[model samples]
Target: MAARKIHTLIVGAGQAGIAMSEHLSAVQLPHLVLEKARIAEAWRSHRWDSLVANGPAWHDRFPGLAFPDTDPDAFVAKDKVADYFEAYAAQIKAPVRCGVEVLKVERGPGGRGFRIDTTDGLYEADNVVVATGAFQKPLIPQVIPADAGFLQLHSSQYRNPDQLPDGGVLVVGAGSSGVQIADELNQAGRKVYLAVGPHDRPPRSYRGRDFVWWLGVLGKWDLQTPAAGAEHVTIAVSGAQGGRTIDFRRLAGEGITLVGRSGAYQNGHMAFADDLARNLDRGDANYLSLLREADAYIARHGLDLPPEPEAHVIIADPECVSRPVRDLDLRAAGIGTVIWAVGFERDYSWLEVDAFDAAGKPVHQRGVSKEPGIYFLGLPWQSRRGSSFIWGVWYDARHVADQIVTQGRYTAYDQSARARQAAPESAIHAAAGDPDGPYPHPHL
Candidate 1:
């Protein structure tokens, strides 16, 4: 079959793609969004049944749509988030084709456009935008022993405690997911063990306001830094408790055993590093740094806000301290399940282009790729610290849409000028059907 031609071809149907589509439609540009699965597939299938968005509903709104009348501070559940994306797409009349898994994307013939091969069919486009997001693949450690006599699952695959056998649960990695899952398992009457790592534990609320509000007021989301490394920390917050901090010390007090970072699994035993205390201290320091920055920003702006509230104290038990376990016998300890919540990585192997750095990451300037007519969206630190968040994608998408429209107009004008130059004056006059010669419009 002949390949379909599109003006703008957008990949993915999540917040990024939807935002881009909305912007493109606003500018009266024709575009098509292709999704490998349903809209918001990650939020629908990868998250746990009870999982909720990390941010409040009010803060998670994308361009041209806001959350329905509800508790603004409430964390939206996964199913509701998925539904919101679906409703937003329908509301905007986004031209999205679901279940169209893209196999490869490369330069088209003669280097005039992009060639996209997908499950649906071959598609050629003048402009291509990648909105697949940074967290495309789960990062599981290569050192995890395959023969270990226990069920191991990534946090993405874990739904609830009932999925595991009746035994102690070992949660490797103490980021938000790891800590939250450990807390859930502990509450479910199972012995839960959390492996401590370097993390940032920010307070959920301060001065009678949610931390997210403070971030907005202080313009934290606008700050742009380098991309996060593999060991990037997370805010220790829980959606279950109305977006409150999941205090590790409180979890330890509730009888959840805390161990250091997992080193390796060998001979039915797991080795742990001896840096739990240091990790905890680093987390505390990071929280303090954030608070200091907020306070300084408030003072600098001379805003008459409420006085700072007294700091909440978290008491960590000695058992949860830096105790190095050279070897932890899983069988003897009766631990039957291991949950790896390390993190996620992006895989761009399907993108056949020379627009990546040595690190295999796309080379882009504020969502605009180095390659002409190619762009990226929904990446952490792509344009700002919040670029990866739902609220932030709108800015990047709008910018990309403007670039596409401007470039498209310029290309059209260039082609029209070339055509006029190639045609004879008599032919041009005949084509114009006017006594005066046909001159291009100034704007064109």
Candidate 2:
């Protein structure tokens, strides 16, 4: 196509990207979704055969449509999710360009809108929505000492427990990934070791009630306004409120050994944090506080809820190795496989914008950034419950797309325009403090 300026451009064709495209379509806004890889590439690349949606099918659906599976509690396989995304893209006829990698997104020279440079070509748009999820890169903690003998693999690369070596497996991080991997290994008849950390222990549902039901009732998941900063803590079902826990007790009952935080794994032994329980307690408190706040909201709103009682966590560690990784020697014990299921971190090196914080994340509120016309979607806890999940992208997509529509025609910043209305040089004062401070420092 020739050099044509578009109304809006959404990067990524995954769930979030497609959802955003649908919202734009609804508003009759002209837009295109540029996908770096094939649609739902994340799900396609998950070669694991046993991968399933940790939650139910009814809850794992995208906006305006539901997965056509019968099992509500059944886990949707990776390939199926990918297929669903493809079908979704087709169903909505989302204007998507596949195999187009966005190399850079920045203010076009004079701030006239965003210049999106891709591998295939270049396009200009009034607004850009980066719906890339947070799982772009795997995060491996530096605390663990590197050794020549041990093979380290992040959870993203792992597919099945049979791929592991003959020795016992050391699974780091006790979140969903950690617990699930450890459970699979143990079920495979291997001596599995899981490292416990602060996590939610919510039941999939309470008394035939989906957890979101309670959230909806409480209005905790209904945060529509933009937050000033990130949430310090989240609720966990695994604490004293046992009902919501992810059934870790059942895993322990099945012979999976749980342990404290893994410190540094040098020669062999892994040292764990001495105050593991204390740390967990603090995390649990934060989670409970969030839940209480949600409950308060429901009560105040007069949400009609059943008289079903709330459940708490039942802490169990039958095969738990409470010692830290630094104190345990795996080399001597013949534990050769090390699965780092800690989690993923976002890396924004490719995003050439000036609004990024020290952590390399784009600073924004309600999908809008200080950098005009730049927005983000599908971020973890971006808004409320649906922020990070596959089903939650539509909410953000609609909100951001609406912004673009309301903004009307976009104007790129030009040098001549800046020169005409530019403020005096003395008017721009320098900062007197550290450059690495919270907000961007104009003074150097």
Candidate 3:
């Protein structure tokens, strides 16, 4: 059978791909979205059962619509997020084919367009938007002993406390997931040990606003990716308990023992770093930075809002973080389970394109890859700090779709970009209707 042809093919049905579909459809552009599972599979299947969106409902959505009948400050449950994406996709009339997994994506015969191999069948497309999102595979460090006798799982696979064996639980990585899971297990009367790391601890609410509101007000979400060292630091904010602040000392006083970073494992013992205080301090610094920024913004604008006393009250590091536990004997601690929440890394090995860098990450200029007819969406810091957030991903998805529509290159925006590239560097600036030489597509 001849390969199915599409003008534009999208390889995800999450927020990014769905948003891209909406933009393309708005302009009457023909496209189809393909997903390995149903829309927003990660939200539906990967996350823990009791998990809620890290962002509140008001901000955790596409620009076109607000979450249905949900309060602005409410942190919608994980299932609701999936429902929102599905509803949004339906509302947009996005043509998505579920259970269709793309096995491989390679250049078509004679280097024209793309040949996609999928479980359903073959497809050829003029352009492909790889919107598989940033969280492709879970990253579980090899810190667990090879012959450990404890039940272990990644945060993605964790459900409720009852899903694991009854004894103590050790939750690794101090990011949002780590903290929340540890807290939940601790609350359930389970002995919980949390492996802390360098993380950003911001209050859920400051003054009269949610922290997300402050981020938008202060323009932190739109800030460009920071320099090397701090770009990948874990953000440890929670939307639990009606969006309360995350205080390590409070957590410690409540019974969750915080340990330093986990390293190697040997002889029924897990070695932990002695830098717990340093990690907590760094997170505390991030916490304080937001307060100061908010204080300055309020004073500058002469806003009526006053500082939130609870948000400003600085708490000292808990006892455990100060004098870190060096080695934890699994048996002695009665820890029967380990939840690894170390985050994820991208996996695009199936995409047979020469558009990746040395570390196998996509190389793109504002979502448009150097490789013609190829694009990426929902990557961390793709354009700014909020690139991975729901709203940011939608924002980015539109830009990518715009690039496709404007450039009209391979599928013909006459992809004047190629002709421009071939033209003499001197002729680039003077090209008709293209005042800018270097970056011709400036939708910004």
Per-structure clash totals for the candidates: 0, 41, 5
At residue 269, candidate 1 shows an lDDT of: 81
Alpha-carbon lDDT, every model: 0.83, 0.69, 0.87
**Cα lDDT of model 1 by residue, 251-288, tens digit:** 78888888888987778888888877878787888677
TM-score of each: 0.91, 0.79, 0.92
Candidate 1 has its poorest 10 consecutive residues by lDDT at: 435-444
User: Better model by TM-score, 1 or 2?
Assistant: 1
TM-score of 3: 0.92
In model 2, what is the error at residue 103, expressed in angstroms? 1.4
The residue-by-residue lDDT of candidate 2 on 15-82, one tens digit each, is 88999999989989888898878998888774355666654567677756677755665557778888
lDDT: which candidate is best? Answer: 3
Report model 2's TM-score to 2 decimal places.
Answer: 0.79
Please list the residue runs of candidate 3 whose C-alpha ends up more than 4 Å from where it truly belongs after superposition. 409-444
Provide the global lDDT of candidate 2 against the true structure: 0.69
Predict model 3's lDDT versus the native: 0.87
Task: List runs of model 1 lying over 4 Å from the truth.
Answer: 227-231, 295-309, 312-317, 322-326, 425-444
List CA RMSD, all candidates. Answer: 3.3, 9.5, 4.9
Residue range 269-349, candidate 3, lDDT tens digits: 888898888888888888889889999999999999965766666677667866678999988999989999998888998
